[model samples]
Target chain A: MTPNTTTADPLRKAASGIAGLDEITFGGLPAGRPTLIAGAAGCGKTLFALTFLVKGATAYDEPGVFMSFEERADDLIDNVSSLGYDLPGLIADKKLVIDYVRVERSEIEQSGEYDLEGLFVRLGHAIDKIGAKRVVLDTLEALFSGLGDGPVLRSELRRLFQWLKDRGVTAVITAERGPEGQLTRHGLEEYVSDCVIALDNRVDEQITTRRLRVMKYRGSAHGTNEYPFLIDKGGISVLPVTSAGLSHSISDEVVSSGVAGIDAMLGVGGFYRGSSVLLSGPSGTGKTTFGSHFVNAACLAGNRAIYFSFEESPEQIVRNMRSVGLNLDSHVTAGLLRFESSRPSLFGLEMHLVLMIRQIDQFDPAVVVIDPISAFRGSESEIHATLLRLVDYLKVKGITVVFNNLVNGDQDDRNEQSLSSLMDVWVGLHDLEANGERNRGLFVLKARGMSHSNQIREYRLGSDGVTLIEPYIGPHGVLTGSARIVQEAQEEAATLERRDEVNRRKREFTEKKSAAERQIAETREALQREEAELLALETVDERKEQILTASRSAAATRRGATA
Target chain B: MTSPTTPDPMGEDGAEISDDGIFHFRLYVAGQTPKSLAAIRNLTLLCDAHLPGRHKIEVLDLAENPELAAQDQIIAIPTLVRSLPPPLKRMIGTLSDPDKFLIGLDYSRPTS
Candidate 1:
């Protein structure tokens, strides 16, 4: 039985302090068992080994022993120092021991009685002296060359593996890869270790990308994809691709799209808070216009906002929006809105991502706008992968995001659709000409949880801001730039003859009434002279009534006798 | 100097106390344990010899300062480090060979 065999469960596993690699390997590398890291030169083999030992010594409190078969101890320390690790200082602390074993097969002969017993003895002595729990054998390829024969080297390798296991110290044995089918020399050392990891430095279509994959891990489950990784000043960072497809439940708080009419088109008149929206259009097609409206509206609604601009600076954006009557100066002073503008080529893609993450984490803006994500295509090496990573990072933090994409004049592809597919909502804008002029048009392609108006509404930008008009060309044709439909309706109302005829008749009637008023005034003057004649006629009528009354009185006596 | 200086109790051959503010000192031992004790003794004598008034000497058993041993990057025991007076220097192996120590530290006799 091995010295640490009684535990059955190894308590001294070397925790690879990488972000997602540990989750893939269950806990970490098997404790006190040799693990082989096979890769080509410049594929991060040395870095992986050094990071393992340094991170173990610094982070996990596990003292380490590094035996370099290639580089001097000083060179290794200098190389890893740029990654923010203090290797020289740790060496000074005695918790970590580094030994350089230089092997030149040409100078030293390998006979039938060759063995690595002396090397093992030094390693064991160092480990005991410092009580090291982790060991790194930088490259075993040099040792294999010294052995000369494959069978003999293989036996020696097997013996060395048993020795490390018996000592109960987790070891990392690194080797350079061979041509094609095998990762390391003859694949002998990999088969002996409990875990095998292969790193690749590949150039595809003239674009160089580094990928890491777990080829095999005995009695364990691990991620199988070749994950993209970045080597920066802070050491190597791997972008775990598996979490890209993970699902999350969306929040239910209502958030404004900055325009009341635009929100009215949505059934709830708003979007779920923390949901991502995509505003897609062509150049000068009001993508930034829409985003500005959202930012201004968010500011007015008491929500802090951040706008990331690639096409224009904050001052330029403010000046342009001023022409459309959006006053952002007060909001800028109020500290409710922050506009960050930069040329995309100013930094590498990951640096931009890290900067954005850092800024958002510090500012903690409620709303974030990336004006025209397509600009990232020119700035990033891999557009879709980088955007997906950024989106994942934002979504994990539950930030409300708005992405503007420029779809160049009618040229659409799977990548555009993929970006649009990532959004919780998609708003498409276009310029259509109908009748005889060009008019602006808007449509909502999709809103995941809310029902929206499916009709293409016409809109006009005036002093009062964007106004949605009834579709003059009705639901079918292009409203193109001139707004000919509106001009046609105006011209149709102008060409009515009945209205002109009615106005003419009303004018003639008013003239006749004025003429009658003049005639009546003349008749009133003549009536002053006719008043005496009329009074004489009234006296004659009164006498006739008196005579008729006298006759009736005489006839009444006769009628009484006849009755 | 006005005050009469004390003689080094742990001094061996080739160790000399100078008049112009320089102290030459040596320690003797056999193995790791004795060497550690000798290093501590020799550091104390030198600290007292050169920095008479305001100085403190610390003795670290290598077995105890095992970490300190690694920190100083000590491969052999009974190492003496001249920490003060600028350009800190160290000598190992119980400092038994005083000529080598003085020459290694550039404090040998004046040729005048």
Candidate 2:
């Protein structure tokens, strides 16, 4: 039955304290209510219940009582010790109480009518002993095997749930999953109508992945998707991708693409901070080289970085990056860079996502590089879903992420296309075959929020680093490699011949002009000499004639001179 | 209740005799409920009929000491446990059926 709270007033939730679980449930399980966790054997139902109690005790200051019907108190404590749960310590501190109710069908004979009041007494006593706010009845269905009165047991089980609610303790009741399509073996889901969570441990392609789903939350708007959860040394972590909605704050800052040439292509000088970049290319197209460059740049900036190499080991990556002038080993030594390498086939897509998230959380890196993410073997949709979550998570944390995907020729473009939608930047690498040579080409297919170059530049990976050479674009289309070299050479020779022809024409014109000038000078000089000689001869004749006249006209000459 | 010094009717059977040849029965109940009273009455009658002057009955009401319920691993109320015998035996519910109750108590009939 639903509580008497007003519909407009939201249901109060008790924080489960499980990582990402609160976010998925929008808060947590309903407070002061029982949540049935049903799962098959080895699916981690007991562990989940224990985590709820332990987390409540340690984190929320909520004392808890664990009434296990299937395992003894000591055995339960021993079982959870591997998970680093200090059950004994909690018990000793008066923060928790564990009561193992052992019920054996052959140990007692039924004579008349009896109820499970003793169970209530034991549970009640333990709860009161610690003032526990949380209670866990692990696999309460064990009663079905230990008792035979079906109707009486069912009624008492119903009363037990009601009693738990009346006591106002947030309870977690774990049950065995029933046969096909049923939520629990005894249909306990019908009793605990507040919240129901189902855990599944499935093996796909030789890899086992554990998943948790909120099947029903009566009064809460919870994430209904099956979230992948991981059980590691740190306990269970659920990867609730949908929890990190598109509401995360964005950053206007930019981080370099690791390679200057790539940064040059991105008009903003780098990718946006907290943005996702998809780097896709065929095999041997230097995808890892680009990723390494980004990581190297991040580490160089004194920012922590994690490189998830799905195809190469850390040592191998360091060695290979050395050839590209990226010294990742030093960064690793400085504790600024970390490498997590594992085969894509080693885990399911969700498991890989959880592992990556865990590593990222632990490292708290400013940048993350999943080199050759296309190495992941799964359905296209599944891979897309996994990447979407990963990108969402990284973006929410404001951590720059680069995904290097290996695209096999043209057909693999479909996979990249589906994932590219989630990326803030997409750099496509390809091998251009020309003039009997294959040259690497890099181009920015898309870069959101910044104007990026669309031109495909010739990418060269030398010992120094990656350089983006401007591809020669002529009438015959973009040319790279030897073809570009040959085209450049031919253009240089034509320029040289044109320069020589212009020089020869200029020399001939100068010679002709100088010869014409010399001829004109000589003619002018001869003409001047002839005029002078003629004037002198005339002067001599005039002087001889004037000498005779001069004697006679001396007197007249004086008067003519005066005039 | 009779004292244990009195002779027992079927004491010759070695299986029914303990170190003191006295039957020790501890009845666990929640309170003075009808079932608890009936269980106590029925068990007392069965003891008197089968092993007169050779039995002792002790009643433990869980309502008075709820914490003691866990000591005997008691779930249902009106649980009768035979503690003094070599082999410990327990029977749940009110002892309505005498034959079944006797069998649960591991009591053997004497040969004529």
Off by over 4 Å in 1: A10-13, A110-112, A147-150, A188-191, A243-247, A259-261, A288-397, A411-414, A417-420, A431-441, A455-563, B1-112
Any residue pairs clashing in model 2, and if so which? none
lDDT accuracy of residue A355 in candidate 2: 89
Q: How badly does each model clash, as a count of residue pairs?
A: 15, 0
lDDT of 2 by residue, A1-563 (tens): 54633323448888998988998899888888899999999898888989999999999999999988888999989988988999999999999998888878887787877778888888888888899999999888888888873898899999999988878889999999999999899999889998999999998778888899999998889898999898878888888876367998999999998888888878789998999999888998998888899999999999999999888899999999899788999999999999999988888889898888888888999999998887888888888888887888999899999999888865657887789889999998998887678888888899999998888899888998898887689677888988888889999999999999999999999999999999999999999999999999999999999798878788787888887
Which runs of model 2 end up more than 4 angstroms from their true locations?
Answer: A1-12, A243-250, A410-412, A473-475, A486-491, A530-563, B1-24, B51-56, B83-87, B103-106
